[model samples]
Each structure stands twice: as C-alpha cells, then as structure tokens.
Target: MGAPDFEFRADLLDQSNEIVLVLDPDTGEIVYGNATAMDVLGYDEEDLLGTSITTVTGFDDVESWAEHLPQDEDADHRGENEFVRSDGERIPVEASVSRTTRDGEDYIVVLVRDITERKERESELRRQKERFEQLFETAGTIMVVLDEEGFIERINDRGSKRLGYERGELVGEHWFETVVPDDVEPEVQSIFEGITTGERGGVDGHTNYVETKDGTRRFVQWHNTPIHEGDEVVGILSSGIDITERKRNEDELERYESFVKSAKDVILSIDDDGFFSYVSPASNSVLGYDPDDLRGTSALDYVHPEEKSEAESGLRSTVDGDGDDVTREFRFQRSDGTWIWVEAICTGCRGGGSDDVGIAILRDITERKEYERELAHQRDALEVLNEVVRHDIRNQLQLVTAYAGMLEGDLEGENQEYAATIRESGQNAIEVTRTARDLAATMIADERVASISLRHAVESPLEQVRSAYSDAVFVVDGAIPDVAVAADEMLESVFRNLLQNAVQHNDKAVPRVEISATVDDVATVHVADNGPGVREDMKDDVFGAGETGLKSDSTGLGLYLVNTLVDRYGGTVHVRDNDPDGAIFDIELPLAE
Candidate 1:
C-alpha cells in the first residue's frame, strides 16, 4: 500500500509541466513542482520544493488568494494572476487552485497557463477599431443613423457641425423636421411612408434640400441603405454629400444647351462613324432636314457628289485623331434636289473614351456664291472684247494715220493744203484711236505685281504734255525719287490724264502745271494746276465711268480708269483743292519692296 501511493504521487508530478504548490490550509508555503516549473523559476527541484510560491511569483495579493482558498480544504478557486519570470519580466497566467490530501495533510494544488500573447492580440484589435471610428467621425460627408420610424438616432461630428447643433442635441429628433420644407412636406411624407411600408425602395440616391439651424436651406444628395435586423427593417443608415455648387453648374449648363439649340446658325456634332449625333433646330431652315432626321444619318451623304471626296477626307482625318482644323466649302443637296453652297468649319472633339468626334458649324452661302459666279462671267466677257479692240483695231488705225502724214509731205500748194487737212484729220483720228487703245489695255491687263521705277514711268507722259503745250509752264518739281511701284503704266496714265485735264480746262493766259512726288512708307504723287477746281455737285460723279467735267466730247474714261487702276493696286486717288487755289490730284500707291 505504501509503494502504490508513492508511485501515484510520482505520476501526478510527471503529468504537469507547471509549478504545483501544496500549501498548508491555514498558512502559505510551497510544497512541490515539476521539472518544467523548476527550470522556469531558474532553481533545482530540491531547492524549490520547500520554498513559498510567492517568492517566485512576486505577487502582493496574498490576502485575496487566501480568502478565495478552498474553505472545506477540498474545493478549488479558478483565477487569473500575474507572475514574474526568472528574467524579471511580468507574464499573465491563469491558475486553478484546489485542495488535496497528501499523506493525510491538507494542501493546495495549483495549475497555471501563460496568457501574455493572447492579451497582446486583444489590445492590438482594440486600437485598430478606435482608429477606424475616428476616421468615420471626422469624414467630410454628413453621416446620420435613423430608427425605423425615421427618428434621428446618432449623427457624426461633420453632421452636427453642418446643422449648427451639438452632437447630443440632434439625437432622438425627427429626421424629417430638419430635411423637409413645410411646402414640400406632403411629398416628403409620402417618400418616408413608402420607405417604412416597403413600397418604394429605400432612398439610395435622392437629391433634396435640408434646412440648417439658422433656417438657411442647403442642397444635399442622400445615399441611404436599410439597416436590417434579420428580415425586418430596424433603421436606416444615411450619408449625405453637399452638392449645391454642382447643382447650380448643372442648371447653367442646361440653359446654355437650350440657347445653342435655338440659335439661328446650325450647330452639329458627328461621331467617329461619321453619323450626326446632334443637330440644332436651325437645320430645318438651313439644310432642309429636320433636326431628328439628321440624327443617325451620315452628314457626308447629303454633300454633292463632286464634294464628297474632300468631305470624306476631312472626316477621316478627324477620326484618325489629326490635330489640324478643318474648313472647306461644299455643295449640299437640299430636299428639293437643288444644291446649295455651305461653308463648314470643323474641329476634332475627344470624349472620355472611344474614338475622336467631330464638331462643326455650317453656314449657307448660296446667294453669295451665285453673285460671285455672275460677276466672274461678266469680267471674262469684258476682257475678251477689250483685248480685240486694243490689239487688232488700233494697229490698223495707226497704219492709216502714218500713210496720211506721208501723202501730205508729197503734195505741194493747193493739193498740199487739202492733203494737210486730210493729215490733220487722220492725226485727230489716230489720237482718238490711241486713247481708245489705252483704255482697252487698262481694262484687259492683269493687275498682278508689276514693278516700275516712278521717275521712268512719269517721264513719258510729261514729255507728251510739254510737246502738246509748248507755251504752257510745266514744271517737274525737284529731283523725283526712284519709287518702285506695282502698277507703273497705270500710274503713268493717271498722271497724263490729270496734266492734260489741267491744261485743257484752264482759262488762264499762262497755264502752269506743277508735278511733285513725295514718298514715305507709301508713295504719293501730287499734280496741281492753275485750273478751276472740280464743281461740288460733280465731285461725286467725277470718278464714275464715262463721267466728265468738260462739256466738250471727252470720253471721261481717263479719271475713271485712273480710279479703277489705283483700286486694283490697293491704292487711292482723290481730287483736293490746291493750296493756292488750283485743282490738286493726289494719287497714293503702295511702295513695292
């Protein structure tokens, strides 16, 4: 019997890896330990067997442990306690203290489990939850929780700050009191009733206005979801985002779109597939197509066949993402099958995704195009007639005048006088023919860039004036600069006509013609004469074709040709009163580089 009891005690020690202390029921003292306990406390089993557990545990709660000790010396008290390790570190432990009879002596048996790692994990989880709650409370959006009956249960810091209320003051208040205006109460009540009765879906994304504590209105977009307890609705969780500025911008954009649709000019957009996506209401008057008819139809289909290739090329360029601006004129077939000219200006438009689109504005130019065509035809006809008269007819007239002069030189006496009269008549005819040829030449020649020196161009007409009026005083004022001009022959014709008109119209005994040239950035020639100035009533008509100041049979083409040629060179010619009471003709021409 004694050997069996000793073996049982050894087996109990081997089964536990903890420090087992069998203490006296009325006193605290250590009794035994396993090998693991002795190794953990940095002591040999023999040395720890008789030592108190408090010496290794370093616990100051000895009295509490004594009170919870087994009263009948047979029960156990389960508790968690702390112990100091051999390295002087505190460790959390769970202990079960029970009374046992060993050799008829009352003692305690204690079981312990280290729980330090478990406690550390619990602390880390607590800190993480606190961080998330802080983020939620400080978010920019207004967050609120409502009971199933739409009563406000809780509001975050942002919500209370926006509503001008203390965090605690808003709780238990009715949600609709703050959000729904009195005028819109019926509609709002219907919405909440639907939510509570489960008729309409919970307001996930609804935009409405809310009133602040100060009675000012605010626009908010609510995103609410039902907080469910099992299958039944318990409450609603809502997050509101302030969108007042965004709503205002949307309203302005809607007004702008309306204005664009009602504009007089056609505004349109085409997708990458070349189909019209948008067309303004003006399409009815401009393109002969209804606005709806243009949608889904290729805009290029209505273009004239001759212009289709160019229009397609531009469209393809836009689809390929080319950056060039597109501007082209094309003929579009109207509803009546008649073609009307349209000028289209297109720009490439790119959206968030897909291929590039094309935005275009089209304008009708049918009347302008028709006028241009008629003007071109008239110009071509006039050019051909002028060419024939100047080149062919004038050569024959020059030959007739030359033969008459030779015949007059051959004859003598009475026959010579008669031949002299014939020669004079022929000469007069030649002068008329020359003037006609010059006028025709002026009308036919291309008015493109033709540079001529100013001095050389003016000498020919000045010599003619000196020869014709030998007694008249003709002064070429100072040394004229060599001015390069685009229309040299036209300038010569202009000066010649003015000088002749000055000499012929003057009733003065000594007719004086002063020709002066002045040049700065632009070239100007002034021809002043001691002749009567143009009449006020005739001034406006002086530049008109076939208008003349002289009552005599002057063709009046001289001043008209001068005005026409000056305009062709982008120059100006006007008559002004001379400084000393004479007629002054001022001609301005651009200086050629």
Candidate 2:
C-alpha cells in the first residue's frame, strides 16, 4: 500500500477537476491518469494508464515531451498543444509538466486547461485590427498621428500630397518646426504642450495655417482626439479638412444673413400674383413648414374666411406694391390647420430685384389680444350695472322717501301708520345697496385662505348681530369648541349672514337665536333660532341665488353669500329642524390637523 501521506495526496488528485497525468520520464509512457484525464480523452482510466502520451496529444511524441528533460533536470515545463480524443476530435489546451519521483522511479506529472475561449477572442482581435488598418489608409480625409513628444509618427497618402510632401518625409518631425506656418506655430505648440502636461483636453475645429513645399499655405480646421495608454494620453489622432474657400464666403455673408435668420418675428415676402417669393428660415418652427415649401403657394390660402376683409387688398399689395405699411391683426392658419392670431406689419418692400413684391413681418400677439377683448367685455357689463345701481334704483328709492314724508304730514292717527311702513321699506332698500356693495367686494377679492379659529368667527358675528337687534335674545353656548377650520377673515361674514337672517325673519316678539359648536374630525357650528322654520321642500331653495323668503326689500343674497363663503372654504352648510321649533343653520368645516 502507498504511504499514508501519498494516499491522501492521491485522493486529492482524483477529486480535482484539472486533467492530471503521470508519465515515465525515460519512456514517456503514461503510468497513471486521473478522472479528469479519462473524461477529457474519452477513454477508460485503465486504457489511459498504460497508453503513450502521444496517443492523446497528437501534436507531440515521447521524445518531444522529454526534449527539455536533459537540459533542465528538475525544472517545470509548459506549452500550448492540441489534445486528440478517442472519438477522433481535437481540442486546444495549455499544459504544464514537472518532474517527479516515487519509489525511485523517474516520472513526469502534467496538468492542462482548455483554452478554446481565449483562442477565439484572440482571433476576433486580429480581424478588428485588419479592418481598422484598411479604413485608416483608404479614408479621403487628411489623417495625422502624433506621439507623446509632439512628433509626427504617421500621415496618410492624401495628407502628404495636400502639404506638398513626399510620403514619409515628415515622419519623426515636430509639428511646430516642419508643418505649421510661422503665424500659428506658437499657438499650436502651446496646445500640444498643454495636452502633454494634462492641463487641457482634446479639441475640435482648431483652424491653423499649414505650409506647402511650394511656399504657399492653406487654412485647415482639425479635430484632435487623444489616444490613451490606460488613463494617460500617449498620442493624438487628427482628422482635418481644408476650409480656405469656405471662410472667404462666410466673411461676405455672415453679418446680414445671420441677422435675417435669427430675427424674432418671422418675415416673408410675396411676389407678383400673390405667390410666396421668400420665407425666412424661421418658418420651420413658426409655421411648421420648410421654407422651400411656401415658395410658390399663395398667401390668402392661410387667411381665415371670417377675417377675409383685407384679403384682396393684402394680396394686391403683395403683387403690385400698391399699399403703404399697415398694421393689422388676423387669424393665420397653421400647418396643423389650427388658427393662430398674429399681428402682421405689411409694407411695400419694393425696388430690389422684384418691383411687385411686398414684405410682411408677423409677430404673435394671441395672449395680449385675448386679454384686451376680455377687458372690453367687462367694461361694457360694468356700464350697465352702474346705470341700474346709480340711476334706476336711486330714483325709485328717492320717490319712496318723498311719498312717505308727504303722507306722514297729511294723515293722522292709525292712517299715518302707512307712512311708517313706507319709510321702513325705503330703509330696507338702502340696506340692499349696502349689502350688494359688500357682496361685490367679497366676490372680487381673491384672498388667501387657511385654518382659522372657529370660536372667533362665530363670536364676532354674534356680538355684531346682537347690537343691531337689541330686542332679540342671542344665546351662544359656552360649549363652542376652541377649534380651527380651513377659512379666511371672510368667515365672520358667513356667521353674520346666518345669524342676521335668523333674527330678521323671526315672527316672535323677542327673537331667540342659539349658537353652539363641536370639534371632531371636522368642526361643526349650529346656529338655531326659535322662529318660523323653513319647509323641507323650500330648504334648498332658501339658499338659491335670488331667494328672498317673506322679505320684500331683500336682495336675496344674504343666505346665498353664506352658502358660497362656506363652500369656498372647503366646508358645508345646510338647514335642519331645531330641537323644538325654528330653523337650524348647521355648518361643517374641515378641522386643521
């Protein structure tokens, strides 16, 4: 039996996933094979044990495996080779061999790993290199390669001819000394130095002058890309084009052409017969059409039908240059067939090439026009309301006051009581105008709302109403909670309206009004009155926009104002039956968390 440690080592070798082999060094014959070796070779372990190493690795024979044995007796051996399987298939592998001895027998141990994936990756890399080389040489653009020292390492065929140099003449030469003209060499050298020192990045559209062999120079715009070795810039790749002629044309047209294209208002000119002659580049965004598409289209095609009064005049002016500059608003049709309100300033842009063409500069005025129209409508409505409140209502109230005063002087005893009724009716009419003014102010004032004290809202209104009607008994239960509700300062008016309506409509000799509040998830206030209550059928109608219940001189806006104010504060108000009699104004408001 093998020694205990050798047996332990043998167990480890059998369980290992690596292919293991033992060969007699002298004969180069396999003496032992591990499980992995048999599995890879597609042979039984017993068959593999006695076979020659050449039987599996067809690329080598016994002498080849032992070739290094004599030179380095105890050294490790490694090589790349192909393994031939029993099923007539070959696989690539990397093998490591070392000399070993057991029981005085010289032997070799080998371990191998499959390298198919690594070989495939290497093949793909080779093909990509070939493709890059082909494109680099054949591309029409001028190409130059510079090393970290700012020396030209390579330049393609097209670049050499452009600079009037034989191929390879400029290789190994510094860019500043050999190629760049004197006027721009200093700047070129500074950029290269900055790139080498890591102070600047790669650049594009760097225009500079380059000298030719004939002593003339051309302007070239170049884009430089830094080549990196890991994270460090080691070289630079540049592609350039000659822009000598392009720069000349740009100098002539840059000033005025740039302004015409970037103008805020879209400018278009129409030729004779009312066909579009020139449309600014801005038409792409303003009208969603390419400028060329409107070149021959008529201008009236986009005018709205209802706004065609100036259509014939505008078209004739564009064709004959007959009209002076006129500013007017019109609805022009957009590409999506929607109408856009635009104010066009049309003028006779005549005497340049086409004598019959007219120019129009259209500026968008949709928002301003809409606001002006809305304000005009509001002013008209206000004029009518002033006529009613200041003239019509005033005259009628004056007549009532005059008649009541005269009746009081002419009558005597119980007949004069009619004058008191008439005088009271005039006073009520005055109160209506005052309430109307207050309601108008409230409706128009947009105030910010927040959680405010409900107790204060009810108490302030209750005290005011008591002072107005001293004969009425106003009872505010101390049980009202010190809670907050989502509302604004207008909350007092809400309570004032409900309380005043309760006492004002009361039939009792002494009106009794009770006020109480509770706080839960919502704060609720109940203003109850001991008087005639609202019927179920008329409960909702009592809060209608024009509801005046049993009161002839009322504006019918008191209860309506109460309900509207409560609703605007995110609260609810409704009438319910009081405990024994009368109406109850129950209000619910959201409680502040």
TM-score of each: 0.54, 0.42
Report, for every candidate in turn, its global Cα lDDT versus the true structure. 0.76, 0.78
Model 1, TM vs. native: 0.54
Backbone clash pairs in model 1 (N, Cα, C under 3 Å; residues 3+ apart or in different chains), count? 0
- Writing each residue's lDDT as its tens digit, candidate 2 over 1-593 gives 12112454777887887788877777767777778888888999667767888888883667875674533446887889888889989888998888766776566778887777888888888888788677667877778889998899989888888889987788888877787888888898887777766778888889888888788787888888888888898988888888878876786679667877998678887676677778888877777678898778987788888777776566565556666876767888888887878887878777756644688787777787899899667766665665576568867887897889799889988879889788767856755664564465456556557888988888887888788678999887876788888888888888888887888788788989998888888898998998888888998788887886655457678888888788888889999888688999999998765
lDDT winner among the candidates? 2
User: What's the residue-level lDDT of 194 in candidate 2?
Assistant: 77
- Model 2: how far residue 99 lies from native, Å: 2.6
Clashing pairs for model 2 are: none
Worst 10 residues of 2 by lDDT: 1-10
Candidate 1 per-residue lDDT, tens place, 434-469, comes to: 555566666656668688788877778989878977
